[model samples]
Target chain A: MKMISENVWEIPREGKMRVPARIFASDILMEKIKADKSLLQVKNVAALPGIQKFSLAMPDAHQGYGFSIGGVAAFDMDEGIISPGGVGYDINCSVRLLRTDMMEDDISSKRKQLLEELSKEVPAGVGRSSKMRLSREELDEVLSTGAKWAVKKGYGTVKDLKHIEEGGSMQGRPDKVSDLAKKRGMPQIGTLGAGNHFLEMQKVDKIFMPEVAERFGITKPGQVMVMIHCGSRGLGHQVASDYIRAMENKFGISHLPDRELINAPISSELGQDYYHAMSAAANFGFANKQMITHWVRQCFDKVFGSNENMDTVYEVCHNIAKMEQHMIDGEKKKLCVHRKGATRSFGPGKEEVPEDYRDLGQPVIIPGSMGTASYLLVGTKKAEEISFGSTAHGAGRVASRSEALRTVRGEQVKKELKQKGIEVWGHSSKGLAEEAPQFYKDVDEVVRVSDALGIGKMVARVVPLAVLKG
Target chain B: MKFKFFDHTADIKFQAYGSSKEEAFKNAALALTEFIIEEDIKAVQEKTIEVEGMDEKQLLYSWLEQFLILLDTEGFLLSTIEELKIDGNKLKAKVKGDSAENYKLTGDAKAITYHDMEITHDDGWMVQVVIDI
Candidate 1:
């Protein structure tokens, strides 16, 4: 590995590598990255067919199944292939923020009640189902229409659409999703599946860029907000499994370095089917968040009289693959950009950005672990040139759940967090133990790397007041 | 414990051992359930599962994936493997477990992955698997 710049490390193209591998990290983070097999995974991704420019990893990079988490790779649409590993098992696993007119003081006295209501209203953990269930036909509508279906069903207001990624919907072919996936998804509409997914109440503590924060409607410190982090649930997992099997069946996995990196040509029939199915699951993810947003509003209303003061700030997907137009070799080309554990940070003036945010750039919500600080940043043109308009999603895990469980008991973690002034509620103590603060990297440092690289600029930061997890 | 967990940075890794292939597979399944929920093995209910695969590795993957699907759809949590038989690429097993809703679950396993996965028969039967959580 060679240092390309101050923070960019390069692994030169060699052997089967179709492109060079680049990792964006500081010297300290680079050492931590090399301590594991993440770099080897990056090299493996570089070897994929039709890869363009470089296969990249963010500062928070960590070893994952096939593609390292925090990985970003773009493949030529015509000659490229779509790999399920590139998008991860949880399709469109994402984060969203909701701003409220209430200040921190308003929520201070009601913390316990608010958390209790949220825990009761939002179904979570293993084998959990939401009170709201859709029929097979209604589930198809959710697959196709995304958040629009929820709004049409009166779950949220029509005005909530503009604050979401892609206006809370994408072009999805519901027919591409299998019956089994549909069945599994029908009962999970508003549920939050387990493993690092959460709903947290927070307070904006600082504003890094007042101008940007003001334009984004995040003015003043001590303001209250809610962050929801989750994904497509069973629907997305089944789609990923189904497509991986289909790809392996058509083109045997003997040639691949890993079975999880299974892929089908983008122009092939199986590839199109996977893309459509993935989009359908992504739609489910959008609708899932939207429906949960309704429940969050209800929770807030129960605690603070009326929730009319609440409004969605923005929603962003961290795990997904999109057919996007990017500049390659001084010419415009369409590519399939896969971000496994990264978020889209499309820069200022992009047509896809919401109108209110077009001048300020898209809002990038980075949720930290319980008892840590989460950040709100904006996309930059520099990111469009360097990291495929993407940035780190979260403070990527540094330790496994079992490692965490061994050192810290769940009840101990809960007590520790309470001592730090952060209330925690969950289904079990073991679940809380797995998400111990030590298990994740310092998100403040992760965002610092992102800002230093100019991929995303920090706008504001919020610390958790209460956390509800599976 | 018939199995022990290995350290992985992001996901869960474990190795199970048994004197026979069927026992190894059964131990592996128990290890998986233990990772998710700490509960007693109550065989008040049972379900017969049949799966087809191209090889032993694929069979292991299919077997685990099927249970994960059941966990998602039917709220079924495996307590034990009452019986197990394998013929070439085909596998038939009778799994016993109570409903997940009645038990206390700690975490959710997303899906069983095939990354660096293998089943070895050195001295005794053993298999290594990584689960995406």
Candidate 2:
């Protein structure tokens, strides 16, 4: 590995690697990133045909199945490939931030009550299903329109849709999704599935860019916000599984270095079908977060009495491949950018950003674990040039789920969190213990690297007051 | 219950052991069951599933995926693999479990992965696999 800049390191294109693998991390973070096989996975991604520029690993990069979480790679539409592992099994695993007019002091007394209401209002945990079961046609609408279905269902005003990525809906082909995937997704519409997914009530502790922060509805310190983190549920998983199997069948696995890295050529019919189905599943995810937002609004009103002025700040998904145009070698090229565990950090003037915040740049949300600090960042133009408009997703895992379970008991973690003035609600003790805050890398440092790299600059910081885990 | 867990950085990985390949596959199902739910599962009903694959690994993946399908579609919590047979690349199994609502499930296993998956025979058969939870 060679140091390209102060915070950037590189593994020059070697042997089978078609492109160099670049990692954005400080010297200390580099050590943790190198602890696992994540960097080697980056090298492997670099070897994939038609990958553009460099295969990049964000600061929070950690070992995942095939492609490391926090890995980003864009591929040529005609010559490149799209892999299921690259997009991850959980399609559109995303985060949504709702800014509230109320402050910390306002909710201090009723914090636990609010959490209890949220815990009831929003379905969570493994095997938990919602009362809202969608029929084939209704689900097809959701798969095709994404969160717009929620808007039609009156989850939030049309203004709320504006703040979401891709207007909370992609051009999804519901026809491409299988009946099996649809059946799996049906009862899971408003549910928050397990593993690192949570709903946290947070308070603004600090603000770095007061000007930009104000524009994002963070007018002052001590402001309260709600962060929802989840994905498309079983439907998305089945879609990924179905496609992976199909790809393996169509193209023999003998050539794949890692079976999990199975891919179909982006230009192939099968690939297009997978992309459409994947987007439909992504739409399901959007509709999901939107519906959750509706229930959250109701819960807030029921608890606080006045629910007016609560609005969405921004929502972003870390998984999925997008057909985007980027300047490669000073020439614009249409590419399929796959961000496994990376956030899009597109800067100001991008048409994709909401109209209200167009001039100020897109709002990038980075949520921390159980009882930690989450950050809001301003996307940068420099990010588009250097890292293909991508940044780290979260405080990447430092220890395995089993390792964390061995280290601490759930009761102990809850007690520790209570000492920090944070309340906890979770489905199972083992699940809580598995997501102990210690298992994650320091998010502050991760954000620092992003800011230093001029990719996604920090705007405001919020700490959790209450956490609901699944 | 002839299975034990191994440390994986982000997800769960396990190795199931038995006297034969079929038994190893059955043990893998039990391992999956234990990982998802902590409570004792009563086999009140039985359901059968069949899958075909071009190779052994795909066969294993297809076979294990059926449990997840049952869980998602019918809310069936896995209790046991009552009977199993692997005829070349085709597999058929009878599984027994109660409705998932009867138990508290811990993990939402998204899919099974082929990462470092191995089905080996050395005296007793051992099959190692990782699941995306």
Per-residue lDDT tens digits for candidate 2, residues A93-157, read 99999999999988989988988898898998888898687889999999999999989988887
Error of 1 at A400 (Å): 1.8
RMSD, every candidate, angstroms = 1.2, 1.0
The deviation in Å at residue A30 for candidate 2 is 0.8
Clashing pairs in 2: none
Every candidate's lDDT: 0.89, 0.92
Query: Which residue pairs collide in model 1, if any?
Result: none
lDDT of 1 by residue, B10-128 (tens): 78888999998888888888888888777785778899999877678878888888888877788888888989998888889999997877877776888888987889997899989
Best by lDDT: 2
